[model samples]
Target: MGGGHTGASERASARATERARSTRLNAAEKEKDERQKNSPNATKAIAEGMNVISTTSLKRKRSVMKQFRGKESIFKRPEALPPRFKNKDVPDYHKHPHKWVRYTLGDVSPEDMSDQSNTAAALSFLRELKERKELIDTNNIELEVPPETL
Candidate 1:
């Protein structure tokens, strides 16, 4: 019991001494600040701590980006198909005033029938290939019997 009391008193004395030292440091700092303010080249100190991180970056994660690099679309920004009216070169052929086509616009025109050559556009290709029939003819009699067994 006697030893405990002495230990308590020692701790109290140590705390008091520490308080006095802290007070002296604070006073000295205040005086230094006043002197700096009085000087022509006074500059305010930037109090940046050790933990001045702008953003939290986990070291475990090599990349800050979300998984799949947002290719999966869940973590990605929203997108949409651009409007078709981007330039003047693209021509709109709808006869109706609306943006969609009419069910039967100019279906049977007598003028179109009269000018058949004007309505047609020719494509360049091999004449022999165009006249040739399909290679596979399931209706052929020769296919029913195999020439030689596998």
Candidate 2:
């Protein structure tokens, strides 16, 4: 839908913009290098800053939250899943063996069992930061709203 043809002006503008961007990136790289020379950890922290929560992003999140002002938002009581697909028993690995049983399934094949397993909404790993922060754990995460809670 976009690029058809560009005249001299458009080509000159594109080259100028590309040169400006390259210049800015090279300057940033030089600054990062200068910081790295002082303490290598600075670079590590800078890198970590991208993945971890940051001030501006956090502020934006907070601003979005303010729209809800005193009301509950985003999160909702997810509807319960239908029973047909809820029939997987915990897997039982009988014994540790040299060759081993790679895996074993019950009467229902995993494919069949999982047809509507996540038909209902998959729970969000809702987390908070800043004011009352919660630890963000990705490796060990609980994605289900336990039946007892329901």
Candidate 3:
């Protein structure tokens, strides 16, 4: 008799658990349906709120910009300031001269003089300068002065 009573209690507990689960499921389904029905209204409210916020922000920004625009000095600078440096009549050499020197290793082409390296290219350049009498060898020059002249 005790075993039968325990068995009946177990079956009643299982049925109670199942009924609670079904009630929860039904509540979840009702909530979902309510949300689906009210979603359009919620979205409309959110969109209207966003539009109001954006328009207020835009108006505030416009007002700030207008304040900044009005803060410009009333006394404007004269437009005729001797035309500055634009029309100051530069010389022909300053405007457009011939030779433009770039003292860089990359500027010296190895193919032009068939130079193997940058040092060789520089040496060849110095040699050309010496041939043209532009580079004077000052290393051999010795300063000599008479003792009485000092």
- In order of appearance, the predictions have TM-scores of 0.28, 0.25, 0.27
Return the candidate ranking by lDDT, descending.
3, 2, 1
lDDT of 1 by residue, 1-150 (tens): 899999999999988987876776568567656764564333322234334422222331224233325342323465887776756555465334577755863786766566554445222234444544333443454577677862
* Candidate 1: RMSD to truth: 24.9
The lDDT, on a scale of 0 to 1, for candidate 1 is 0.53
| Candidate 2, 1-150: lDDT as tens digits | 245455766998988987876776568567656745465454455778745554654564466446446653335778998676534654344433554555656665676567465443232222223223333343234544465865
Question: What overall lDDT goes with each candidate model?
Answer: 0.53, 0.55, 0.62
In model 1, the runs with Cα more than 4 Å from the true position are 43-150
**Best-first order by TM-score:** 1, 3, 2
Q: Highest TM-score: which candidate?
A: 1
Residue 60 shift from truth in candidate 3, angstroms: 35
Clashing pairs for predicted structure model 2, backbone only: none
* Residue 27 of model 3, lDDT score: 82
